[model samples]
Target: MIVLVVTACPAGLRGDLTKWLLEVTPGVFVGTPSARIRDLLWDRTVALCNDGRALLVYSSNSEQGMEFRTHRHSWVPTDFDGITLMMRKHPPSEAKRRKGWSKARRQRAAYEAR
Candidate 1:
């Protein structure tokens, strides 16, 4: 089985993906298409996503029994000792990091200033 999740992508792309997969939700598709078709769909999604993000997950023979691919997203797919992993890439700038930091960080900084 294959499952695809798209976020902030064009409506047309979602419609196109629906042709080959069932859209269980607004931007989520699920199906069991052939590998070639799955790859093609992923390519098309990547091309149409532009600045949006997408994730494709499918059954696999790996240790996890599933594999996933990501495009134009902050979270990245990584390989660790034959295991597939997902990790968030660091923000590009300190300003962005500060914007996302938890309130605990601010509290710690305030305590340190005392």
Candidate 2:
């Protein structure tokens, strides 16, 4: 995933970062800007920003899409930084896992147990 920083002061430049992502990283997820860090862009899953203002703009996964959640300024920064660093250090997607059991398997298991 890629992390992006955006400045509200710059309008046209905002799309520049998006365009870059399109060219270099087509499957990137973009996060909203905050009071300090600005923005974060990640690929695949949603990127969490501690900056309470963080908004998710791009996400391949619909579930983790942007949804505003209130957060305190004191804790947000640390949480955001920690989560960002963790994501960068060890990035993983939940969708890549095996499908596990199907309906038929569940039914069979239930019947066997009975």
Candidate 3:
């Protein structure tokens, strides 16, 4: 069995994928297709995804019994100690931490000053 998930993609991609798999939810599809069909679907999805992100998960004989692949996404799939893991890409430290007080914090400070 295979599952495909697409996010923030074009309507046409969704429509095309529906032809091969059942759309269980807005961006989720599930089906049992041959390896060739699954690969073809994934290739087509990559071509149509453009700036969007996609994830494909399928049953396999691996240790996890399932494997996943991702495209155009911030979170990356990695193999660690023979285990599959999802690693998130975080922004630079400067962008991660606010340089100054947030609006709510500033407002509270002003109220305290009053």
Candidate 4:
């Protein structure tokens, strides 16, 4: 069995995926297919997805009985002591703003002052 989760992608990609897998919910697909088909599907998704992200999880003989693959996703799959895990990443400090207030805040301040 394989599961695919796609987000912020074109409708065409989702429509193509429906030919093989059942979309149980928006952006979530599941199906029972041979390993070859699963790999081919993943390959096609990788090739077609533009500026979108996908996460693939399939049954395997691993310790958790599942494996993961990601395409263009910020959270990466990692092996921690032989166990698969998803690692969350924080944005760079440079991307964080340390100063300045928005116009909304300025307006609120003036209102409070009045």
Q: TM per model?
A: 0.79, 0.21, 0.82, 0.81
Candidate 3 backbone collisions, by pair: none
Error of 3 at 36 (Å): 0.7
Candidate 4 lDDT, 1-114, residue by residue in tens: 999999988899999999999999999999998999999999999988999999999999988999999998998988899999999877777667757999899999999998
Per-residue accuracy of model 2 over 1-114 as CA lDDT, tens digit each: 334332221333344456444323332224444423333232211223322222233223334432232222121222352232112223357777678798899999999998
Clashing pairs in 2: 1-43, 2-41, 4-41, 29-42, 32-55, 33-38, 50-80
- Worst lDDT run of 10 residues, candidate 1, spans 92-101
The candidate, 2 or 4, that scores higher on TM-score is 4
lDDT of 3 by residue, 8-98 (tens): 9999999999999999999999999999999999999999998899999999999999898999888888899999999988765756575
lDDT of each: 0.92, 0.36, 0.94, 0.94
- On the 0 to 100 scale, the lDDT of residue 26 in model 3 is 98
Q: Backbone collision count in every prediction? A: 0, 7, 0, 0
Q: Name the better of 2 and 3 by lDDT.
A: 3
State the number of backbone clashes in model 4.
0
Looking at model 2, residue 29 earns an lDDT score of: 28
Error of 3 at 114 (Å): 14
